[model samples]
Target chain A: MIRGWLSSRTDLPLKGDAASRFLPWVVAVMVYLAVLALAGALLARDSVLRWSRSLTGTLTVQIAVPAGERNLDVAMADRIDRTLELLRRTPGIDRAQALSADQISALLEPWLGGGAIVDELPLPALIDVALVPGARVDLKALAERLAAAVPGAALDDHGKWLKDLIRLALAAQAAAGLILLLVTGCAVAAVVFAVRTSLAIHRDVVEILHLVGARDRYIASQFQRHALALSLKGGLSGWLLALITLGGAAWALLSLDAALMPRPSLAWLEWLLILLPPFAATGIAVLTARLAVHNVLGRMI
Target chain B: MSYAGGPEIVSDLTFQLAAGSFHFLTGPSGAGKSSLLKILYLALRPSRGIVELFGRDVRTLGRADLPALRRRIGVVFQDFRLIPHLSALDNVALPLRIAGAKEAQVREHVSELLRWVGLGEQMNALPATLSGGQQQRISIARAVIGRPALLLADEPTGNVDDAIAVRLLYLFEELNKMGTTVLIASHNESLVQRFPHARLHLEGGRLERRTA
Candidate 1:
C-alpha cells in the first residue's frame, strides 16, 4: 500500500514546472547546512563531556619556587614533598605523586620546544593528586592547610579551566542549534514559494480536478508527494555531501597532534543523529506544501 | 452572481434538476451557461441565492463537506480540461482514485470506459498528443466514469462530429436511465431540438423552463 501510494500519478504537471525542478536543489543545500550544524553541536557536546569526565576525581598541586631561583631549590623541593604528603593523608585523596623534572619537560614540549632553554627557565614543582570516587574535598581548606604546612604551596583542582571549557562548549552548541533552526526556516519558506508558484502555474488543471470530484486533500496530496520526492532527493544528496565533507575534515585533522586537537569522532548514536536532517528536511517540505495547498484551496468556491 | 465586484453574469436563476432526469441548458455565448454549470459543480458560489445539491443547501455546506458532495457530481468543461500531463487512462481514473477506490478496480473500470469511448488504443496517450475531438471524448469519459449522481457538461460535444455528439448524448442518457441526473449546456439549438429532454434556456441571465 505504501509503495502504491508513493508511486501514484500526479494530475498536475508539477514535475515539468521550473519551481519543482529547483526545489530539490534548494532542499539539498538546506539539509547540507543543517547536517553540518547539527554535527557540530553533537561533536562539541561529546568532546566536552569526554574532557569533563576525564577531569573528574582528579586534582593538581603547584609549588612555586622563589622568584630569583632559577630551578627547584632545596626549599622548593621540601615544599613540594610536604604538599604531596599532606594530599596523600587527606581523607578524600587516594594518591598523590610529585612530577619528575623529565615529566614536566615532556608536558611543556609542545609549547616550549625541546632542550636546555625549558630546563633553564624558572620552573615550579608539581604534584598530581587523585581523589576517591564520589569524594567531596574542601579544596579551600586543603589549600590553606598546605600553605600553612609548606610556604609557597597551592592546591589546584582545575575547576576554573573546566568551567570555562564547559561554557565555551555550551555556547558552541547553542550557536549550532540556532543555525539549524534558521536552515529549517529557510527550507520551509522555499517549499511554500515553490508550491504557491506551482499552484499558480497549474490553476486550470487544479480547477479541472476539483470539478471532477477531487477534494482539496486529494489535490494537496499530489503536491505533497512531489515535494516529498524532491526533498528526499535533495536531502540525501546533501547528507551524502556533508558526510564526505566531514570525512575530509577528519582526515585533515588526523595529521594534527592528538594532544593539540580534539579528535573529531562520532559514536554510532551520533552518526544516527547525523542521518536525521535529510528525513527532517523531507518532512518539512511535505508539510509546508500540504499546508500551502490547503490554505489556497480553502479560499476557492 | 458577480465576479470581483463586477456586474452579475448570472442572477435570480432558480432551477432544480430531478434525480434520474436529463436536461439541455441552451443559451447564447454571453447567456451564462458556463457560469451556471460552474455553480452546479461547486466551483463558484452564487453571490446571493440558495444553491442546493443532493437535497442540501450549498450555502450551509462547509469547505470540508464539498469534496464528498463533489465526488457525487462530475463535470466536463467546454475547453476539454484534461490534465495535460496525464494519459487518457489516468485522467479518466482520477475521480475513482480520488474517492479511494482500489487501484485494480479503478484500472479495470477506467480501461473499459476508454474502450467504450473509442480510445482503447490511446489509453497511454497524453492529452497534448490527442486531437481536439479525441480529447473531448477523454474528457467525457473522465466525467461519467465515476457513475456520479449528477453530471454537468458544458459544450461537451463542441469539438466532435454529429455522430459522435449523438453517441455522447446517448451515453449521458444511458447514465440518466441508471438514476444519474445530467445537465448538458450548449448553444447548439438543432441538437437541443433533437433531444426529447426538457430544456432550460438562459437569456440575459434569466431562465425559461421548457417542457419536453
Candidate 2:
C-alpha cells in the first residue's frame, strides 16, 4: 500500500520513473503560509498568554469631583484613603493602592502635557487594584460603599474593555486556524485531482495491466506510491519554510521585548507538536493518492 | 453460466484444443471468431455451457480465481496491446513481472524471447519506434515469453508481411510442440489453407469443425 500510494503523482507511469510534483514557486507559497500558521499558533499559545497576564485581573479606578469644590480636598482625600482600606479588607481582593500625584502626573504626561505646563492641573484621582484568580468582585456594591464613605469616590472595574480585547485575540486565532485547515484541504484535493488526471491520460496503461493480468490494487499501488512521495516532499518543504519564517519573526519580537519574550523556548512537548507538519503532509498525500487512484480505476474499468 | 448476451460467439463450441493441440479459428470478418477466442483466453465469459481449462470450470470462476489461470494462458490481442512507454523488452517482461518473477529471471527470459522474435538489438526501443510488423512480433514475444500452457492469438498475422507471417506461424508451431494449446484467429483463408490444423470455423456466431 505504501509503494502504491507513492506512485500516484507520476505522469510517466510506464517509464517506471517518478517526477517531482513540487513546482518551486508553489513550494515557496506553501512555505510562506506554513510559517504564518506556525506563528499564529505560537502567538495564540504563549504570547497571547503573556499579553493577558500583563493586563488581566487588574483595574484603574478614576475618581472625579465636580469642578467647583476644590477646597473640600483634604477631608475627601482622608475619606478616599479610608474607603481604599475597606476595599483592601474585602475577600478576593489581592492588593489595592491609590495613585499618588507623581504617578498620575506621569500618566497624564502623554496627553495632558508634561512638566508642570499648567499651574493647576484638574485631574481625577486614580486607584489600582488586583484580584485573586477565579475570584469575583461585586463592583456595584463596592461603588455604593465607597460612595457612602466618600461621596466623591468612584470605582473603575476595567472588565469590559479587557474582555473585548481577549475576545478579539481569540477570534483572530480561530480565523488563522480555519485558514490553515482550508489550505491543507486544498492541497490534498489538488493532489487527488492531479493523480486522477494522470491516470486518465494513461488509460492505455490500465488497459495493458488489465489485459496482462495486473490487479487493480497493483496498478493503483504504482500510482499511489508516487503520489505519497510527492506529497511528503511538498509538505515538508512547505512546513520547513514556515518554520524559518516564524523563527525570524519570533527573533525580531524577542528583540523588541527581551525580558518579557515568553521564554524564547519551545518545550519538549511543544516540539513534538511542532513536528506534525510533515506527517500532516504525508497523511494528505496518502489520502489524495488513494482516493484519486481508486476513484478513477473504479469508474474506468 | 448464462450471461445476458444473446448469441454465443462460439455456439456449441465443444471441441477442446487439448494439450499440444493446434487449431485455426477462421471465418469472414465479424463472424465472432475473435469473440470465441476471447472466451477461450478468459477475457470473456461464455453465455452457456461449461468452458473448462486447467481442470477448473471457467464459467463459475471468481474474479480473484481467474488471474492464476489467466497467467497460465498467453493471449495476443489484435491491436498488439503493448504499453506505449515501455521498451520492447519491458513490454515482453510484463506478464512475468505480474507473475512475481524476479527482475533477473524476467530479464533473462524476455531478452532471449525478444531475440528469438528478431528483436534482440531492439529490446530497448519503445513500441512507437517499431514498425507494425516489429510491434506485432514483440506482442507475440510477450504472449509466448512465459511459455504458457495455452496461446490465443487474434489476427496474429494480419499486419505482418508474408515472410514475417510465416515466421510467426512457425513460432506458434514451436510453442505448440511444448504441450501448449495454440488457438489462432484469422480471416486469411489462404494462410489457414496452407497451415493444415484442426479448424474451428465460425459464421454468424455459430461454430463448426471444418477441414482446411
The prediction achieving the highest DockQ against the true structure is 1
Which candidate leads in TM-score? 1
- Which stretches of candidate 2 lie above 4 Å from their native place? A1-38, A45-47, A53-62, A71-80, A99-126, A131-140, A150-158, A240-279, B1-20, B39-69, B159-179, B188-196, B210-212
Candidate 1 structure quality by residue, lDDT tens digits, A1-301? 8567667777788877897898889888998898888888888888888988988988888887766555647777767777777888899999898999899999888788879988998788888888999989999999899889887787788889889988988998999989898999999999999999999999988887777767898899999999988999999999999999988888888877647567898999998899999999999999999999999988776
Alpha carbon lDDT of residue A206, candidate 2? 77
lDDT (tens digit, per residue) of candidate 2 on A23-114 = 22343355457547655766666655666677678766666754566675775486567868887888888988887888877766656666
Off by over 4 Å in 1: A1-5, A68-72
Worst-scoring 10-residue span by lDDT in model 2 chain A: A15-24
How large is the C-alpha RMSD of every model relative to the true structure?
A: 2.0, 5.0
Q: Against the true structure, candidate 1 has what lDDT?
A: 0.88
Residue B15 local lDDT, model 2:
71
lDDT of 1 at B12: 87
Give all candidates' CA lDDT scores: 0.88, 0.74
Worst 10 residues of 1 chain A by lDDT: A66-75
